[model samples]
Target: MPQISAFDVVGPIMVGPSSSHTAGAVRLGLAARRILGEPVTHADIGLHGSFAATHWGHRTDVAILAGLLGMSMDDSRIPQAKELADAAGLQYAFQTVDLGDVHPNSVRMRVLGKENSIEVVGASVGGGRICIYEIDRFEVEIDGSYTVLLARYKDQPGVVADITRILASYGINIAFMKVSRKTRGSDALLVAETDDPIVDDVLELVRQLQGGIVARRLPRF
Candidate 1:
């Protein structure tokens, strides 16, 4: 099959006018909000190539800020995302960046709040699709398709199996799983589109591991 561009995707189940540019950006923003773990008071965003050049024409900025505000992708408020963000007292800015060799449609968002500050870099692939290329300066890939589980444990064997077993015991089927590490420590990001919502017990079981530091239940909105 031939390769596809941001404008070539087609679908109706979406909440926006386009999938690749709008929906995908919104998802990225929402995921950023999740990682920040708090309502951001201010933000500085940088867009690359297509995103920086045509974000206004395509509402990419709106979708992005709306995600930070925890708004739905389809919400009409997206059109007035900046205004709404200002009204909500969230500080923000947008700019274009040159990422010569990187993907054409890419963005780096910096957000700040009284509670914390965070930076996230990701891309809108197409058809309102998003992939979190990096978080908190950590390089990892996360497709916002399911409730994601972020785990931190020692660099030992059976860590992956232990996590899977906990989910399996609760009959939770992991739709996707990706693992990464940096020197003595390892990280696991599990995205599960389960038959049932992720209950507390299932989450607690995974948290029981020695190196398990955090587990998040991220549902698609």
Candidate 2:
């Protein structure tokens, strides 16, 4: 079993009927927005397993919409999230889906902005903690425990080395890293959890590599 922390028992300070279904859902949405790194124009949310069944009872729907609007769990406007989203001109829809072999309290968000779009899948693993499992089509594990750098590039030789060199040049130390790809010679993803914040200059350098790269930072909550 996964080790539990003290906060897991005490729960997060949030507007909630339940931590897992409410606060956790909010965090998941925030994580999605963080990945996008811009204002969301549209979102398609899918709830699976237990979240689909008990979402309404816990107001998980509202919590998620509130999150897509960049509202934190403790935001005073959570109760008025729907109105706030409408005021911000954010469009959204929700549906129940069969996300096989996953945690019960899980959701998938397809978020779009004027300049970019992304898909994120995550699960509320009790307390107010969540684990993001997918980004775009790449499978990943992002729990918001630390600052992370997500890099997308062509699956080619020396790409990882090149990116790491940029991080080293910025005096950033990597704590953990994972790589995923659809197939050889296709696109690939690299997630690096860093001990120090990656500066924008380093990110710009990584993006300049190989003429086709996208890099974004995910800050810890």
TM-score against truth, every candidate:
0.75, 0.95
Which candidate wins on TM-score? Answer: 2
Q: Rate the local accuracy (lDDT) of all candidates.
A: 0.74, 0.90
Score candidate 2 by lDDT: 0.90
Q: List runs of model 1 lying over 4 Å from the truth.
A: 1-10, 13-19, 35-37, 112-118, 154-158, 186-196, 204-208
Pick out the ten consecutive residues of candidate 1 with the lowest summed lDDT. Answer: 186-195
Weakest 10 consecutive residues of candidate 2 by summed lDDT: 4-13
Q: Per-residue lDDT of 79-175 in model 1, one digit per residue for the tens? A: 7878889899998888888856767778898988786676788988876668877665566667665666655556678877888788888877777
Q: Compose the digit string of candidate 2's lDDT tens values, residues 37-77.
A: 99999999999999999999999989998888888888878
Q: What lDDT score is found at residue 127 in candidate 2?
A: 78
